[model samples]
Target: MNRLVTVAEMTLRELVRRRGVLLLLLLMPLTFWLIRRDSHVGQSVRALLLGISWAVSTAALFATSAARELEPRLRLAGYRPHHLYLGRMLGLWALGLAVSVPFFLLTVFDANNLRYAGIAVAMLCCVAVAAPLGMLIGALLPREMEGTLLLLTVVAVQMLLDPTSSAAKLMPFWSSREIASWAVDHTDDGYLSRGVLHAAVVTALMLVTVAGLFGVRLRRRRHLRHAPLV
Candidate 1:
């Protein structure tokens, strides 16, 4: 609908206008990739994936938080809750894809013998998981400070966890690591399958959560009934 597109376009414009934040978002993954460039090829790629995940999620959180007051007004002005959430989500996805492209090219140029398709898939999975996760966090925690601290804690645990542990799969970016393994090491089809499955499950759950919360938060009031005018 035109309403959805308008909200999405407005969200995109706001995100673009934050030039400094956009630069920092793009820089984080590049810096991470460089940090492990000398350590090991796989390390750098995995770090880059994680960086991308963190950057996208953080951006989503900020976007959702920044729009908290604006959304209710939009809902009052003929916009539905789903329209607001989905539009914002689409904008965030576009932003995430924009950020991921350069890093994907870097992997193509800097790394050797990588399954390029797998690398792209892993980055997609990272962005897919991160956007909803951030929106859900923003919905649940209204305060940006709290949402950010929680995201930092989650990212820290994700990086520190043993990949072989069952617990690792619970982390939002686990798919990034698994698919990165397949890309860099030419692992079996199992890695790709597991990564894809994990991403689907997490993305579905987060989207549902965001939808439910937004529906309730922006629902029309029961007590303040509007009667038809003569």
Candidate 2:
């Protein structure tokens, strides 16, 4: 437990130190929110949620990429795979929440007649799903640029695709859109239920995938087997 907490703390500190990255991440969502502010409240809120997910996931991707070299060393120092990934994930989730709070408050003050609770839930879902998704991408793609391009492609699809289409359901941030519909459009309870379920399932799958990847990649190999004493 202490080890996990230590890794998480280190992750938080490391990310916080990247002042430029933090500023950009914070700006992305605010930009999204501002773009649609005058057009439609629901669109603005939905875009805001997507921006939050993108920002957090991007952070997670960069964090995981940055730690790729250090993680093996940490493993040598007795850190388990779960400790490494889960701890970093916890930190990213915390960061994601911090990024969401300002936007949440923005909605509160700028948009009237919203189900604020649903917006909060959507933000939680975004943070929960995004962290592992980013880590998974970071693990698979050795180059940060490649992983970033893929992440951008996914987010672009999520934004441009029709939410009602079957293909849109596969997108990681779909739950946020669904719940945003419930919150903004005053849709039925079914939307909320589906959104929550989708978020839970996606988060579980991504975490498992990331764990497997990290385990294989970080496993210590017998590259130099010791011989019997001469």
Candidate 3:
């Protein structure tokens, strides 16, 4: 238990040190505020939260502490790779929620819109889901430069594909535009039932997928250790 806490704290501190997390959690929000300064407060706030989620997800992927260090050092330290992976995910999720609270408060109280409150909640869930997904990618790829490229490629593909298109709606973190449109077309009661459920299911699936990949990596590492060298 103490080890898990230590790992989580270490992961958060490492993320903070990278500076990318700051840019994502701070600068991106500031950028949205600057560009949309004259826009309707509610709309601007919603856009701000969306932008924050995107940046946070990308930054989390690129700033993973585990990926930055050599696997040999990690194995040598007697750390359980799965625990370390889970701890990193836990830390990153906390960071995502930390950045999200301001956005939620802004939408709920300052923006004077309960709908945006729902949207904000949904976006926070997206960030929570995205953290492990990002970490899984980071673990598999491990190189920051390559991981960044891969993250960009995946985001680009998701944007182009529009998982919420008429055919499919199960993609992890379906974009804000899709959610907003659903909210507009259907009443809050109807949208909540469909949209929130979809989001929750997708989020759960993402976490599971990430855990599975981490398991696979750990198994491969153990297998390599037992194999005879040529």
Give Cα-based local distance difference scores for all models: 0.93, 0.94, 0.63
Question: Model 2: per-residue lDDT, tens digit, 175-213?
Answer: 999999999999999999999999999999999999899
Quote each prediction's TM-score.
0.98, 0.96, 0.75
Write model 3 residue lDDT over 62-153, tens digit each, in one string.
65634555544665676666666677777888878777777666555544434664566566656776787677667667677787787666
Q: By lDDT, is 1 or 3 better?
A: 1
Q: Comparing candidate 1 with candidate 2, which one achieves the higher lDDT?
A: 2
Local lDDT at 6 for model 1: 87
Q: For residue 177, what is the lDDT in candidate 3?
A: 41
How many backbone clashes does every candidate have?
Answer: 0, 0, 0
| Between candidates 2 and 3, the TM-score winner | 2
What does the lDDT come to for candidate 3?
0.63
Model 1 segments more than 4 A misplaced: none
Model with the higher lDDT, candidate 2 or 3: 2
